[model samples]
Target: MGSIDSYIFRTTLTSFAVVMASLTGVIWITQALRGIDLMTSQGQTILTFLGLTGLAVPVLILVIAPIALMIAVAHTLNRLATDSEIIVMNAAGLSPLRLFRPFVYATLVVSAIVILIGAYIAPDGLRRIARWDSEITADVLANVLQPGRFAQLEQNLTIRVRERQPGGLLVGVFIDDRRDPNDRVSIIADHGTVLKNSEGSFLVLEDGHLERFQAGQQEPALVAFSRYAFDMSKFSRARDVAYGIREHYLWELMWPDPNDPLLKQLPTQFRSEMHDRLLAPIYPFFFAAVTFAFLGLARTTRQSRNFSMIGAVLCAFVVRLAGFALSVIANQTPYVAGLQYLLLVIAIAVSVWLIRRNVVIEPPARLVDALNALTASLSRLVRRPMPA
Candidate 1:
């Protein structure tokens, strides 16, 4: 490659990297802060929260890369234009397409990275987070029975144990089952082990006495046994309590069982989530296109350039918001599914326009001049006049 080609390539690549990193840090920090409350409620540690939240960085980058690219491209070209660098290159007969070849290469590399993240890395991280939540819930529920205290497992069932250990072993275990009006059963065990089998989970007791009470009789009947078993599987279901849609993956969400009472009937969110995953990989391309638009409009002042970059970013976000709103509305009407493709096409058109208009040393002078005049007029209206 020639010196000018190498120089433009290096400058644009450096700008893209710096911009992407800064935005990723900002987005991750903001999301982590907002999610801290939910994490705490789930008993997730700070490290786990950070790691789980960090998984979302790839998705964020996928969204933000195009914006950064647009800003960087705009800034790089604008600076070159302001310094008369573009004029030098143009005078030497360097075409705009030739100059943008390196940039196109740079954008393709970024797009590939975004695709890998959205498709594989992001999904894997989300799955890990769901599993972590499942394990934590199980641990909390299994530890519900405390030593030396009468802990009520349910409205009619009270359990008191002197000591508890791993492998479902319990010492001085007592269960008071008042589940029936006609008959009541009380059991005390010297030593017990929780056993999970096909019949369901049960606590096998050793050196225990079982007492049965009948509604018609005043006295209770007691029977002693060397080993007795008490069913404990009913408590196991509580450990599997899922928070909501966030707990399941695409497949799990789609074919949920008819008997799964906890699963809400909102199939829209699941469909939306599936669409979101499929659509996430393409966001980088849109961002890149938008970046081109921003870069196409160049200015002399750094502050002015910053303002322009912010404006482009905001506009992109507005487009995203509109698409999301449309997706929600579409769930109510099946015909709205077409809007997703419409959003994608719009993004592609914007990118193409940005490239076509800004690929050269600068965009057409008349268009730039008109935008400047409009902006100046808008600024004047918003500005307060000084007292005469």
Candidate 2:
């Protein structure tokens, strides 16, 4: 009995590891490709990119782990049946219930992990990613102007023909400042540099022209300049936090500040979001049960045994789509109608039924007899001589 238990555990764990690693690799590669544009725009370093990717792994694992486990278990059981190991176990008085112990243990371990990630780790990682993005955006905006391009710095200022010298000094600067709602000012220079002057940072233009347009004047007044300075520090400190649902944790979602502009008008959306995040962890357990149960519809060794695997995948898609649709509907409605709770209850009931049905039942004898007869007919047909 000890040997059998050990063998089952080892085989199942091996399968689990293979499936997890492969799925994680595939998901990571896809995410990395999708994020390339954002990464480049942020001027992210290789180390930063790698760190973000690493942090994403835990979230992916939490989401995909159950599906991986289901696939691994189904594949392993199929192999066992094909090799006649299950038949041998049956002959040795190993009941189906006894054989399911390892899987149950595995499911418990996976469920705990899923709970941890969904509740804590994922939220923390999300916060960090948001902060990193804010920082990168600040950096990009600070140095947005470039050479041979008319860079529009906000709505009021336009810079044309900007260049930087070897000493890190910028030259050939042109600035059009229309920032004043009542008056418009435009400055151009043959040679100028951006400097951190006493009054914040300033662009000191040399040998330039200044044009001021008064509100009532049809013609703009033009003035020549020897040296003119404009403040260069247009980019302000980053106000990183947003009042969006994605930025908050579970508790924050439930008890969001009424003072927050985002939550000031609509509280129902926040409540629905909280429910959705809280319920995400339950999906893995549901998937595990569904996969195990559906796999038992046919003998594990049946060549058409992939039906359950396909069903499991479909189940995942349907659940995701349903959740999305529910969230949208919840946002539109004014009250919390217990729809999420109802789904949870239905999922639990279905999962329980699947597990119980799969664990205790055996494939029908009539089906087996039919399969045997079909196999015999196919065998003779293959061996028969071809018609000349």
Q: Which candidate gets the maximum TM-score versus the true structure?
A: 2
**Where is the poorest 10-residue window by lDDT in model 2?**
296-305
lDDT by residue for model 2 (1-388), tens: 3777777667776888899999999989999887775445433457878876777787788667877777777776777777778768767866655666666666667677777776668777877877766765554223465566787877877777566554445567777778887798877788776576445666677898988998989999999989887765556345556635655766777777778777766677777767767776666556656665665333435445544566666876786567667778888784543676677568757756655554434436797689789999999999999999
lDDT of each: 0.69, 0.69
- The parts of candidate 2 lying over 4 Å away from their true place are 1-14, 38-42, 51-59, 140-143, 154-156, 160-231, 254-264, 296-303, 315-324, 333-388
Model 1, runs deviating above 4 Å: 1-14, 33-47, 78-84, 141-152, 157-275, 297-311, 343-347, 350-388
TM-score, candidate 1, is 0.58
TM-score of every candidate: 0.58, 0.67
The lDDT, on a scale of 0 to 1, for candidate 1 is 0.69
For every candidate structure, what is the RMSD over all alpha carbons to the true structure, in angstroms?
A: 7.8, 6.4
User: The CA-based lDDT of model 2 is what?
Assistant: 0.69
